[model samples]
Target: MIRAARILFKATLWFVVLSVLWVGLYALVPPPFTLTMAGDLFQGRSITKDWTPLADIDPDMPRAAIAGEDARFCLHHGFDWRAIAGAAARNAQGRRIRGGSTISQQTAKNAFLWQGGGYLRKALEAWFTTLIELIWGKRRIMEVYLNLAETGIGTYGVEAGSIRYFDHSAARLTPTEAGRIAAVLPLPKKRAAIDPRGFVRRHGNAIAARVGVVRRQGLDACLK
Candidate 1:
């Protein structure tokens, strides 16, 4: 019994190590299918966290994103258990809004793992999420998210999305403008980043309200 337990522990350790290596390796090569979407790992570039620094962007941009996606970004170690629990409960009631994966998780999935929703995809994503959160921390994860979120069909990154939609850089995006951008992320084409319709406008306003709350409650409270 003791020998068997020791062997099982060793096997588990190897599996964990291999999984970490797999994610790290994938980060080196761009996604296999290679489409021209947000943060598609342009033809000639190496991976670097500094590729897009969080400080280079407008503060309101991240503020809106955290408000839209993961208000707990600053606080969580990678996973947002509350959001995950809420999503699961909603899914059980047949009212799932798709996903509750945090921004850090999305960065890991997009940068390393494959797309589509499934138990397997989600399991890998969760593991990779934790690994990257430990490896990259909050700021780098946010930087990657701003760069990789699919704002437009062919646009990638806040810089590209800003230019593609607004003909301006991300730094010029106002709070309302940033909210509009955040609104479209869940339904990229259906919601125009620059010219939101009534539905999109409603969503954008909701995100803006969250941002205001964050400002009042403080960034730390927003995470909570």
Candidate 2:
């Protein structure tokens, strides 16, 4: 039993060290690929992505993301307890399941982990989220999230999604365009940013409107 405990301790120590190094390296470098990207490739899907720096991408894009996804992105460290409580209460009502994960958490999951939910995954996500919040900061977190998030089926990143949907670069996305892209982010495989209908269209429009609010209220202050 003592030998087994010692082995486990060594393994955990190595894990912490390696994970720290990985996070540190990614702070200075864009992650080359993620597990989700590999999953798409294995399924015979053609991946489309372009890693545009946050400065090169339009400011509206992040604003739209913050408005539509996490309004408290700038205010929180890595988690928002109020959002979590709200999501939990809503979930208890038996509606569509919602997650209270902040943009930082999403970045950690996309950059270093896989999709889907499990207790183990959630715990790991929390760990990485803390590391990123401390090491990567908000600006880096937003940058990585925009670059790594799946914006459409077989498409990753705002730059690729922008070109595919609007035939233009992300650097010049209009508010409407950015909001539409952000709307499709939550369910990229099922939604279309261009010519969206029903909920997607409404959500996109709402997000577009909130883009102005995000800017006015400085909700995206962290990025600056």
Candidate 3:
């Protein structure tokens, strides 16, 4: 029993160390690389990695993002405990399906972590999420999200997604088009902004509906 206890303690210690190290690294580094992507490369996969400041980005980008990724983004510093608790309870009752990771959490996972949906990855995600919240402010987090989000397998960032989906820059995306882009974030591969299918249309409508809600509720309310 004593030996088992020692092994467990060592494991716990190692995880804690790794968590601290990752957060410290995030605070120090800008972004390890312009692109930390995975999977097979494809045509038209080049990244336009201009370090545009947060202000340069369209307000609708973060607006829709907050609406889609974490409606409570402005209210939460980083983690949304209510959503996390709900996800935990839901996952516990079943085969452990879905998570309540916020936009900040997803950003950390995308930028610094891997793609696996494992418990280990989730724990690491939470650690990095907290790190990003503490190290980077709301503006920095949104800026990073715009740059790192995967619109396609090899394509990344709002600019890339905009170009790929609509053959235009993210700066030029219209409200209707932006809603379409935001709708498929959950299942990007299965949906597209240009798809004539009813599913895409329906999703666009749903996103459009929430656009006003997000605006009227005030963008900052999502931070909690």
Candidate 4:
């Protein structure tokens, strides 16, 4: 028992050191690829992504993301307890599942962890989220998230999504265009950003409206 415990302690120490180094390295270098992208390849889908700097992506894109995903993005550290509480309450009531993950949390998951939910994954995600919040800060987190998030069936990044859906670069996304892309973000494989119907269309419109509000209220001030 003593030997096994010692071995476990050594293994955990090595994991902690390596994970910190990994997060620190990515602060300067864009991640090469993610597990989701590799999964697409394994399933015979071609990966499409363009790594645009946060400055090149239109302000509306991040604003739309903030509005549609996390309204208190600028205020949160790495997690939003209030949103998590709300989501948990709604989930307990048997509504459609809602995630309380902030952009920081989402970035950690997209960059380091795999898709889907499990206690183990969520615990690891929390660890990575803490590492990134300490090392990457808000702007870098948003930059990484926008570049790594899946925006379509095989598409990754807002830059690629912009070109795929709008035939234009993400550098000049209109509010509506940005909102549509943001709407597709949560369920990229299932939702179409262009000519979206039903919930997606309505949600995109709402997000578009909220983009201006996000800006006026300085909700995305960290990005600026």
Candidate 5:
């Protein structure tokens, strides 16, 4: 028992040290590929990803994502307590499991962790979210999220999504196109960004409207 405990302690210490160094390095350099992308590749799924700088991406794309995912993104640090409380209350009432994850949390998960949900993944996500919030800030967080998020089956990033769905570069995405992409973000594997139908179409319209609202109210001022 003593030997096992000692080994566990050493492993835990090493893990913490490596995690810190990894986060620090990513704060300065863009990650080569995310864990999710790697997992997909290992599963023999084709990946279509094009790394594009935030400046090269259309301004509407980030705005639409912020509108759809976390309207209070700029106001929060790493988590949104109001959204979390609302989701928890709804879940307790037996409603569908809705996630209240902010862009920072999503970025942390996409960049560092594999895709899944559980206490362990959530805990690690929270840790990485806090680290990115402190080190990467809002702009960097949004940039990484936009670039790493899976926008469709095998499609990664706004650039690749734009090209795949609209036959255009991300920098040229129109408001409606941006909204469609953002709408599919919640369930990219099931939703279609291009030629969206039913719920996706309505959701995209809602996101587009909110994009205007965020812009007018300067809800995304932190990125600027």
Candidate 6:
């Protein structure tokens, strides 16, 4: 029993040390690829990605993303309690299991955790989200999230999405174009940002309006 306890303690210590070092390293350097990217490659899906700095990406891209995914992104410190509470209440009423994950949480999941819904994944995502909020700050968190998010089936990042969908550089995307990209974020594989129609078109328009609102209200001032 004592020997088993010693092994468990040593394993726990190593896990903590490694996790800290990993997060610290990523806080400084951009990750070359994510687990999702690797999984796609392993599954024989052609991955298309171009890593672009936040400065190189159009300013509207981040605004649209924040507007669509997490309106209170800059206000929260990794988690948005109000959104969580609302989602929980809705779920308890037998509604769809919509998530209230903020951009920070999404970044943590995309960068470190695998794609899926589970308690263990949520716990790890929460831990990494807190670490990033403490170390990477709002700007870096948005930067990483923009670059790592799956924009389409086998397409990753704004750069790739821009080139594939709009035939333009990410830095040159207009607000409408950026909004369209943001619109498909929830179900990228099933939506197209270039020639959005029906629901996507309307949703993209809404996100574009919210982008303006966020800009005027300084909702993302923390990134500045």
Q: How accurate is candidate 4 locally (lDDT)?
A: 0.95
* lDDT scores in order: 0.73, 0.96, 0.71, 0.95, 0.91, 0.91
Q: In candidate 5, residue 64 scores what lDDT? A: 98
List per-candidate RMSD values in Å. Answer: 5.5, 0.6, 4.3, 0.7, 1.4, 1.3
- State in Å the error of residue 108, model 5: 0.5
Which model is ahead, 2 or 3, in terms of TM-score? 2
List model 2 lDDT by residue over 4-84, tens digit each: 999999999998999999999999999999999999999999999999999999999999999999999999999999999
Give the per-residue Cα lDDT of candidate 1 at 55.
Answer: 68
Residue 15 of candidate 1: its Cα lDDT? 80
Instruction: Give the distance in Å from residue 26's predicted Cα in candidate 6 to where it truly belongs.
Output: 1.1
Weakest ten-residue segment in model 6 by summed lDDT: 15-24
lDDT of 5 by residue, 116-223 (tens): 899999999999998889878999999889989999988999999999999989998888999999999999999989789999999999998888888899998998
What would the per-residue lDDT of candidate 4 be over residues 98-195, giving only the tens digit for each residue? 88999888999999999999999999999999999999899999999999999999999999999999999999999999999999999999998989
Candidate 5 TM-score versus the reference: 0.95
* Stretches of model 4 off by over 4 angstroms after superposition: none
Better candidate by lDDT, 1 or 4? 4
Clashes of 1: 1
lDDT per residue (tens digit) for residues 30-52 in model 1: 23332333233664533222134
For candidate 5, the per-residue lDDT at 185 reads: 94
Clashing pairs in model 5? none
The better candidate by lDDT, 2 or 5, is 2
lDDT of 6 by residue, 71-174 (tens): 99989899999999999999999998888889999999999989989999999899889888988899999989988999999999999999999898999988
lDDT of 2 at 5: 100
RMSD of 6: 1.3
Q: To one decimal, what is the Cα RMSD in angstroms of model 4 from the true structure?
A: 0.7
